[model samples]
Target: MRERYEFEGKRFLVLGLAKSGYAAADLLHSLGADVVVNDSSPETGSKEVTALREKGITVICGGHPENILDKGFDTIVKNPGIPYHNPVLKQAVQKGIPIWTEVELSYLISEAPIIAITGSNGKTTTTTLLYHILNIGGKQPLIAGNIGTVACTVAQNAKPDEVIVMEVSSFQLAGTESFRPKIAVWTNLYDAHLDYHGTSEEYALAKAKVTDNQTEEDFFIYNADQHEMLPYIERSAAMKIPFSLQGKKAEGISADDEMIYWQGEPFVKRSIIKLLGQHNLENILAATASAILMDCDKETIENVLSSFTGVRHRMQFVKELKGRTFYNDSKATNTLATKSALSSFQSPVVLIAGGLDRGHSFEELRPYMGRVKAVLALGETAERLVDFAATCGVPLAVKVRSMEEAVQEAYGVSVEGDQILLSPACASWDQYPNFEERGDAFIEAVIKL
Candidate 1:
């Protein structure tokens, strides 16, 4: 839509055909580039694959061919989930072919200035919040990236007057080269995706790429509480803005128990904010800072914050039956997130947790388990989490086989005024495809009850 001619006539390889891959291949082909799409998944006859082939783009499926790179492509638009250690990607590296995620493509073609949010957690909440704030403030904003909608697909129709609020993941950032956002936010850093990155440092660096191509004209809003992020902040050429839960002294955007401050000035009172958890306060501060930079009015920000409960699968309230409230937080795929969810409630909790093991100890959750009345664990890490719950001295700890079982058991253990929460501190990959499906299962089970 922005009349990008750089991709024209260039030979491109679009790897791993999911949503991002399909969008990338389609965009590249439309731009008059010679595009070949490859996917390891055996969805060869799928609608997307069929469509691409009909458009005269080569669509290869089932597995990566050893000689696939023989065609001498100018660039590879790779799907984020595919690791660099992948044989075809490793070969691309050896041959010095440029590899990019679809975000890079999105950045190149979009007429709209992008506001990107990335971190180990809170990306979805922060992205959604900022989008809401900007929308309510009369700014035309589009939501895209890792939050679900393909960014390139959004970019194709993005108007120059619009703004793109993107949720970027470490995997997507890792494959980026020239993908700079006009406003970049690093919510907070934690050890995550170690298997994909091989080390915490690599993961952090990948997250840092949101600011990599930025210049002094851009804005980098980061978590001041994360000392590990300081070095990266100092190195960025973008104008630095910080947000913290640690009061007004943070000097950018800070929050106390009473109020949210903007550069040491009172902006909004804490009581008016509706989102749950201290971690969400961090998200609020970050989103508020970005909105202020975008010239969104304080009243608009306050209105959005006061009413925005949360994004789905992330501390979303379901239903209250017989005075026992249910919340679906299947997005809490790590201990830190679960800790935040646990801290949000004062009532005794019947927590339904556990999923893919990921070989990490749930010991980090022990200190926050004081309010957990019972633990209904499920999936690959069910037994281990229940054992850990026992060690935490939780009164009722049981391993359940499925979400339905977990929901039933949680209700059985809960009493009047108790909170039944589905905040799995592990990934849903063991039993569900993703956190969303896991959350949907929990919600359906709760509805059934």
Candidate 2:
């Protein structure tokens, strides 16, 4: 078992009963901390809540208490998804109570070195690929964080010889203070999560925090092509390593369309790569760099690259119905990601898009609209996207009320050799809880057809 950090008498307020919060609350309570777990839901009799109560930990549900700020907490471990606009969090800020994400708490207790991957996109794909490569290379590897598993939950069980590969998000990175990775892979940056961070600069700053506490002993693998990330790269104390599809030279890692070079030698041939698209190429390059840095052999890296299918809901193929191919890219909740998905194929696409409006225009996606045969828009921004699609020279644009309607409309217009893509250039919040749920619905609908 990993050694526990001292929390014997510290008071902690876990401000959500999500996976991270539940794990953190449990860990802190086990270490003899005065833990208070709170959630807005009225699941007072829930298993986790009841267990915490049995251990003498406080469980507050039904609603957030008005006096939560006065509870005298030494620190507030918030679930990353919770916004700063929450009344309790705002009050805690006013009271000067320290706020932390479970990532920070995990760092305090983890004995294993961490390879943390963060960016506006490709974090999950790169993290999973690195984990696979490391495992194949004979390194004891465990994957967690942001891909459904909580950080602290994995930390408690981590062995010293293990490598914890984590998919970190901007939300999770923003709340971390002293959480540093031994190897940090920042895939690429883009304008995303503006609703939470409020600005592109703030969003980038949050991602840069993954390397904030890293030292010279650490490695920072980043996109050499992301000129905007140069400022953050200059600020990092870690040894800088660059990965690029443009063939920028790094001592151990560099790549072109043909092959990836390690120490000036061809490591992995690009011809065998299973995942298509330039964005996925970037992900593979970053993952290959991190794997090599961890001493993974060329064979392992090449094997994983050749066999790795792709991450779910991100350009995932559904089924071919009546000579039309359907792709579920519901994870493309932003214009940049959706654009990447659109660029993957040469065939004209019957595009199903739109969702919760994040106050951003779809103007940037206009260029990719040339490849779209028709647009079946849905969600809060459905009507607005139709106008944008029309302006982009798309002849057919329909505003539908739901995903099923969008799919049905797209199928009517699609023909042999035309692809149907559900790459919403907006979030799923207006219709579904998350991209996964939205993607599942699209898959189910396609299967029925």
Candidate 3:
């Protein structure tokens, strides 16, 4: 296990008691700091709270108490999901106690250098691909952050020789103060998480924070196609390396339909890559730029490109049943992502879309409707999408109640050489906890067929 950072006699208040919060609280307690963990949930018997209590750490449950300030906390390690308007956080700010995310603690403790990646989409695929390339190139890489594992927990157990490759989210980045990575990547930006972030400008600002702490020696890899990010990129101290799919560039990475160009030279042929879609091409280019900048050889990069199938639930190939292929792009939780998925295919697709309605319209997706042979929409936006499909002049539009029903509907209309795609343009919160669960359900239903 990696050694804990210094915190002897320091008083820390940990808010939210979720995975990241518990990990931070536990770390602080282990380092001889006076730690108090608070959760709005009353279930003190929950595994995490119980474990902390077993460690002789203080636990406050049911509600956030006002007396937390009386405890004289030197720092407040907050769960990234918790809003700034939360009473405990507001009080902490009023009292002048510095609030930080668990990532900050992790960065302070980790001896390993980091490669942090963030964007509205494609973060997981890019991060996983980079991990594969780094491993093949002999870099001992550890994956963490929004992909699943808690960043601090990974950091606390990480060895100095390992390279921590984290898929960071805007939520995590918003809480960071000094969490600098040796290499920072912004895949691309789009208007997303507006419900949580309040505005697109705020969301973009949070993503930009990934490179805020970088120095002249660090590298910033980002999408040149997203001119919206240029202002923030210009302000960064790190050397900027941009990736694009539109045209060949003099510096950084870019790709056409045939070859991926790195610094204006042919890096890899598109025929060698196993993953599909224009979005996946962008992801590959981003990963390629990062790996090349990190000194990974061409042979290793090519091997990974040829072999790596893809991350689960994002353009994952399910099966070819009765001569029709199926793809699960459940991670396409926004209109832009769904459009990217749709634009990737030249042939007509029986598109299965819809999920929790996030107040965004289906109007932006109209242009891509020509490629969709039929529409099997489900979840909260089913009927609305069906109505929108009617306006798009889609040949067939059916509103289904469940994923199984949608899959069956798509199968019924599909013919030989056609594609059935599960590229929901909304979140999975209405039907499942996350997109993976929803995607798993779709895969399971397909297997049953």
Candidate 4:
């Protein structure tokens, strides 16, 4: 209801007419900023675009005209899907226009505290889990960001006492200015989204911004297990909190002998998380650490973990037919994450993989190939993967196209005690809308069989 920016009278260019961009345009206008919103869509009949014109914000739907980015504007803010390296974004950067993401803009205006979570993987599970624990502990936390919700909308409408639990992505992180979370959590980092961020280091730099502007009073919770993040962690002067899943000597929170602990603070009750897989255990540790640091009641933390159902696409069980289990791990968009999903199963697996090739190495997928019954490759990357897995002793590999064929072939080749895992260690844009669609298709195919 309130305007955060005084830009109500200044010129602003809003790019990417998606949810965040539209919200950003409206928020700027509420502050008296003159804004023009653009979407690449070639049609002007969209309901949200129509609403923007009605609200008195300038709406230029049907495609982004190049002249728009060239014109003088006070600042530029982008939606999460708009790559930081886009030509328009690059031009804006060259013009020295102050660029910002929706998260950054929201942070600038919010009166409430924030706990922003960012990572190549694990952000959604960690963000949602943290929110669940906070609610159980009696805190009002609004969940938003790359986890399929507009945080700017939530932050704009929430009361001052309520906090924001944000799942920020690398795209959102790149253009951030003066955005800092009270408790910033970086779960882990791997080489992902090279198509957008260009290099793994650049991508990590964007993600590290979760703690970028943090002060010593703010908490920077990171994975002690990811050595790549250690350079940033060591240099961070913020109140450092680290979590681990293996060995002792880890500081902030850890799990030992089927028990979870936060900073040596024993939980009031012994808790056994119901989620399957060791990767889920890692998510459990991160959530427990952040909630405890937020001063959530020990009992609330324990209770929430018990009730926390895992995220939809990450290792979601479809069915057990003919004595073989089917798991939809469409969220495993990288080798490391897929490896984690595969490592959870002790039985032999007919692992269905391959998708939009992201320059990922199958070397990491090698160690776990022994447990995989055979490799079922799909999409553009299939042929190259067959050879890679064979190096790890998987002599039998089947190449198929589409999730249906992969599932059918897997079922034909697998028998009792073997698992059918759709854990493709690659992006889904080649054949699906997102990981969700890919995972959904995998489930649908399994149900048909």
Q: By summed lDDT, which 10 consecutive residues of candidate 4 come out lowest? A: 263-272
Candidate 1 structure quality by residue, lDDT tens digits, 261-317: 988998899999889999999999999999999999988998998899999999999
Best by TM-score: 1
Cα RMSD to the true fold for all candidates: 1.2, 1.9, 1.4, 2.4
294-385 per-residue lDDT for model 2 (tens digits) = 88987888788889978889888778887899898999988989999988989999999999987788877888899998999888998899
Give candidate 2's error at residue 430 in angstroms.
1.9
Runs of candidate 1 exceeding 4 Å displacement = none
TM-score ranking of the models: 1, 3, 2, 4
Preferred candidate (TM-score higher): 2 or 4: 2
lDDT of 4 by residue, 1-449 (tens): 33554665788888888788888888888877888887787654788877888998777767667788656888888777778667777888888898888888778777778889887778888888898988878789889888878877878786778888999988898879888888888888877777788888888888888888999989988888878789878766689988877644437877666566666655533345766777777777777777877788777876776776677888877889989988888998888889899888888989999988766678888888899879899887898788787787885786887889988999999999889999998889988878899999899999899
> What's each prediction's TM-score?
0.98, 0.94, 0.97, 0.92
Candidate 1: global Cα-lDDT? Answer: 0.93
Cα lDDT of model 3 overall? 0.90
lDDT score at residue 36, model 4, on the 0-100 scale: 84
Write model 3 residue lDDT over 359-426, tens digit each, in one string.
78987888889988899988899999999999999999988989999898899999999999999999
Show the lowest summed lDDT stretch of 10 residues, model 3. 1-10
Q: Looking at model 1, which ten-residue stretch has the lowest summed lDDT?
A: 242-251
Instruction: Highest lDDT: give the candidate number.
Output: 1
Candidate 3, which segments miss by more than 4 Å at Cα?
A: 1-6
C-alpha displacement of 379 in model 2, angstroms? 2.3
